[model samples]
Target: MKKIFLLAALIGFSPIFSQERDQIRERDEISPDNSWLKVGITGGVPVGDANNASSFALGADIRGQYLFNPNIAIGIASGYTNYFGKDGFDDFGVIPAAGFFRYYFTPSGLFLGTDIGYGFVTNVENNDGGLYVNPQIGYHNRDWNIYAYYQNTFLETDMDIQNVGVGVTYNIRFN
Candidate 1:
């Protein structure tokens, strides 16, 4: 009797399980024309004259890109980067607004990219924004990106801020 009951239960649930599997298979199909947003965190140590004032750096950013094909893309990115102060210095930050370009070595993994724009200084007075450039290399897949970048900001005050950093982003797709 117990063996017969077990058999009956399996039969009852088999159709439900198969239906779920079919739904998953349908959802797994991805289209090439989709755009994606990458949301992530970034951190770095100050280089050049920036080291004299900042001990380290940390920030977050969001980037949206439209794929022209499997390998090339263009996008815009914006984020905040904070430079922690050294002794007797106050912490400073920059809100960076940039346009970026990327080339993927493969359809979904490994790429090169760069951002060019302006960094608006924050938490300081009597200052204008600066030129911002970041060149990066990374591994990208359907869901994540891991990268290393060099960031530079050329200030009008005759100072240059530089950083060598690593960042990670999670990709969210839209049709």
Candidate 2:
């Protein structure tokens, strides 16, 4: 009777230990990766010293970033801005090109970004370029994005320009 009971217990537990589905999941269960080009439309008013000589501004930016990991990305960013004329200065344009990075903090696409490089200021007659820095925060998604950012340009002989703005971006994939 003891030998029969031992054999019954072994047979009952053998299938449970040998099951493959309990140790592994299906391969196609994860979400697709996000890495692509970004085109944005932005508009906002100049702030601080920039507002002293210029009116509101409108701008656009382009970026190509690679999602190196799920939460981080690095790439190139460039922008074009036009500030309205005011009493102290004529209308001017701003162009900045920089190496940028974005860091996502949540699973739902909240992120912070920063960029540093050179910026160009122009009124078609006299042009000057200098150091640039940009910082941003918003919700970044694979399909769409919305952000608020600040632009700071350090000029060689003129006062630094500071503009604050909000933007919307769309993500596109070729394949």
Candidate 3:
């Protein structure tokens, strides 16, 4: 009876020990490569108050990224958003252009990044310019990606705007 119990314990632990050994081997075999480029499009709802009016903006963004190494990458993105007022006031449009530096934490392509850029907001007749900072979290696979970010818009005057958005992206890899 004791021998059968010992056999059962070994059988249960053999696969777990083998999996740990394989993970150690994988860590030793990882290397950096920089031969791929990915481009994607994303659309989402932007959470913010549009000039004291309770409204959310619909936004779309285009992204281009190049792998400099397995762990580091650089990219650029441009986004456009618009909010319509509830009353007879004018609608507002915003254009944001930014660059990003990304650090990948896993080979499966989970990343965190920061972006800095400027946004131009325009109404029917007047326009204003603001600087923006966005901190983002994202995941990338062979052909699919998703991201979420929070943006802060700082105008030259004292007006400040904050936005939180979540987006899903599909990538086209260039040959």
Candidate 4:
């Protein structure tokens, strides 16, 4: 019985120690890379007055970026968020185009990011367009990302609307 157990352990250990270093490196090179485009779909709950007037918010976004040494990225972003109506007010929606920026902790998956730009609020009454900004914190990997953020619409001389929510992003890489 002792001999059989020793033989089994040696068989398992041998395969690991016997692997060529070059073969491991070659296998790593064959694996898919994380670069290029990231597309995201998000849902948010309205906060403050925005929530009283609307039920929730939903949006979609796209970004193109270059990884500058694996810790930072910058790109452009645009999306539409629909704020559903509740009882008193009508549905509100905005189309925002912005510049995207992100910084990740080196060798870790945590990140902080932001988007800022002009947003046109087309479906609301008695107000013009506004400035759009989103600040977010998230965990990300090569396959997927998850984040929580505050999205704000600041209409000049008028009320500011806030949407707070979480979102998921899918990553697509190109070689």
- lDDT of each candidate versus the true structure: 0.87, 0.80, 0.67, 0.81
Runs in model 3 deviating more than 4 A are 1-51, 124-127
TM-score preference between candidates 2 and 3, better one: 2
Answer with 2 or 3, whichever has the higher lDDT. Answer: 2
Off by over 4 Å in 2: 1-34, 124-127
Q: Provide the TM-score for each candidate, comma-separated.
A: 0.79, 0.76, 0.67, 0.75
Task: Output the TM-score of candidate 2.
Answer: 0.76
lDDT of 2 at 59: 85
- Clash totals for all candidate models: 0, 0, 0, 0
Give the CA lDDT, 0 to 100, for residue 110 in model 2: 92
- The positional error of residue 81 in candidate 1, measured at the CA in angstroms, is 0.5
RMSD (Cα, Å) for all candidates, in order, is 13.0, 8.9, 11.8, 12.9
**lDDT tens digits, residues 14-84, model 2?**
88766645543332122235457788888888987779878898888888777766788787988798888
Those runs of model 1 whose alpha carbons end farther than 4 Å from true positions after fitting are: 1-33
- Candidate 1 lDDT (Cα, 0 to 1): 0.87
Ranking by TM-score: 1, 2, 4, 3
Worst 10 residues of 4 by lDDT: 26-35
Q: Residue 38, candidate 3: how far off, in angstroms? A: 6.1
lDDT of 3 by residue, 1-175 (tens): 9999999999999999999999876654423243234434443344545546425656666667766656787778777766656566655666778887778787677889877888777663433868978788988665666787876667776665566777666655544
lDDT of 3 at 59: 68
Which is superior by TM-score, 1 or 2? 1
Give the candidate number with the greatest lDDT: 1
